[model samples]
Target: MRLNDCLTPAATAIRRKAASSRELRSNLRASWGDGVAFGGMVGFGETYLAAFVLAAGLGELTAGLVGSVPLIAGGVMQMVSPLLIRRLHSHKRWVVLCALVQAAVFAPLGYAAWQGSISAPAVLILATLYWASGLATGPAWNTWIGTLVPPGVRPRFFALRTRASQAAVFLAFLAGGITLQLAGGGPHLMTAYAALFAIAGGCRLVSAWYLYRHTEPSPMPASMRNISWRELLGQLRSGNGGRLLLYLVAVQAAVQVSGPYFTPFMFRKLELNYGEYVALIGVAYLAKVIALPWWGSMAHKVGAQRLLWIGGAGIAPVAAAWMVSGNLAWLLTVQVLSGVAWAAYELAFFLLFFEAIAPEERTSMLTLYNLINTAAWVAGALGGGAILFLTDASHAGYLIVFAASSFFRALALLLLARLPAIEAEGEEIGLRTLSVRPNAASLDAPVLPSLPSQAE
Candidate 1:
């Protein structure tokens, strides 16, 4: 009794907090599994796919198409997500099944590579299936996670989750680069790709397992309003929300104009070894890991819109910077700068997209927005491919394409400049203060959305 009486209230408080912490962990346990699963995907995606395709004897056009065609197909595939959700009664079910399919898509590829069956067209077709499965999962999964996390913890939780995923991606990318280089580029390289992709698929299956465990708020909340096509079209025409969506499409179109070609340029033209290529790409991911929070802070200080402008304008010069030098050190510097700008632009875009759309409507809007965004990426890829083709895939051609990409990015910034800034009450929005969702009443936010199109 004497010892208890002597004890500080702070000690009791600490005990209480510890108990609550365990309860919190129980509630969010599924999300933890999901995070681990997503980390696995970092090992292989579009970037690695580019390396694989090129090593398979495909040309620049094939590399560009690797990113482009899948996105184009995925966008079209996503249009059906809402319908699937309607039939399934649970977003988790849809996500889990489709994700398993995505993983399985890799299995056949391994067999094909071993059989000498891998080719540009075969890769494109298989990749299309791979992307279709994953992309379809996104709409359902984003909607599901949005309902899972409470807002008070969303900012920090999402940031931490994203950092973890990015870290995994960085490590995975380093591993892939090493595997490709050590394995050496030749006919045998296809076997290596098959094995790596198979492993990557297994990772996704793990993610699916975690997703299956996640606790989702009832898939259909009470009295929810379903947005119709006419309303969606109207938003595109005069709504502030539509403008935000268009801003993204514009920015991405600008970025992709030269984005997909970087692989071909470096690996084929500059002849950077797999390690060097990985270094260039991996640095950007690392920068993202380090800089995302900084960007979030800047967004807090200045405002998401202002940072977006800075990011938008800042991003425009990055592709052009490559034109100034082919030196690895110089290119590495360019990647670091690009990573910072990417953090700013990407964070701002995520926040802006969520802020402008309503909660119950996110599933529908995101599905549509992603579809359009995917289409824009394809357009950008096609534009880059055309430039390279016209120039005979020459180094000069790449420079010209890079220069054009810069112009388009600047033009996209101008569009952003015309848009209105997001207003906040009592406090400026930072990653800490924000959840990147629609109205919490029924909104969905993608804390760790699979940002596949971003780097690759």
Candidate 2:
């Protein structure tokens, strides 16, 4: 009787494990497809919003404002996301709602374009509501996914997810860009814009449906525990997580200083068509796809903080590289460099961040972190706008902003030294099993000798 009883429980446990594995696989496949559609939507829509404003005869400063104002409002929305999520009692629900609203916002944009009323101010108003709704979905989705993915599998999963998404973005950008050029070859370019936006809306609607179908592992409670402002401030001053957030903020701000104006510079000054613009971005995305696996493998061996340093240092020169040339080959080379650098940073940033937080704290901390990040990005865009205003949109003015961005990026790299070289959720990092360095070949010996903990 005792043997039978033990066997029954053991057999039941095996069955349950099998069932869970099946579910995880199902969710992962769904999520992968979701990523594909979402990536396509971003390429078709998000990447072109500023450019569309420029094409609509809004000029450069208005383009900057269209990107900035909506984003700032969205950042403000993030502040309330935690409270709203608590009241709603479901992260997935919040994500679905927001995603749908973001999708719906684009419908009007398409109509506005068709109606010939898509002015800069109109874009700002519509985009704010669009971006705010969209931005609020981010932290919620991150937190919800945190619960879905097993901790042991996060690095590989995230890296793969990123690679897949980047690949999709590249392909979609090619198709969308070609579509735009062909459409604009017609009698009315506004019709082309409208068609592009309609496709984007459909892509987003599919993403929302995927969001709805993803299995919610558990219902988030109505209330979450949060640390006091005083406590959070202390951590920001001294803790690893806080410092990491600071580093991300600094880097994003530096990037945005010139990021928003790149399209304007390319379109107005370089005289690139939509196809050429998409090609530049596509090259970058391709580089990331090629580089992701190597970066992912290195993550387990060298640690995310160290990789962050390498990425930051690599990225610092890329924006400034723009000022050196307008040659297509040179710009393509810059885009490739930019993509490789950002892949390392993006992969490490997320893994380390999730590692630092306890599961219980993810909802609040992620939301707050995103809130601050959005604000920093908006501030950087505003700073760039100010510079453009002062320069009166001269070629020299654009160059000055680009140069300032590089300087700030280099400044941001200084923060990496302050971060600890630890695994996402483990002890201080040291010489570990080194993976094959991308450029180095084995000479029947280890490429990297186990050394003292710090590379420096």
Model 1 earns a TM-score of: 0.86
Tens-digit lDDT string for candidate 2 (3-22): 54766777978978999999
Candidate 2, pairs of clashing residues: none
Q: Give Cα-based local distance difference scores for all models.
A: 0.69, 0.70
- 308-419 per-residue lDDT for model 1 (tens digits): 7877877888888989989989988888888777767767776666565556666667667768877887888788889899999999999998899888888877677677
TM-score of each: 0.86, 0.83
- Candidate 2 deviant stretches above 4 angstroms: 1-26, 149-159, 221-229, 351-354, 418-456
Best by TM-score: 1
Model 2 alpha-carbon miss at residue 113, Å: 1.8
Positional deviation of residue 356's Cα in model 1 after best superposition, in angstroms? 3.3
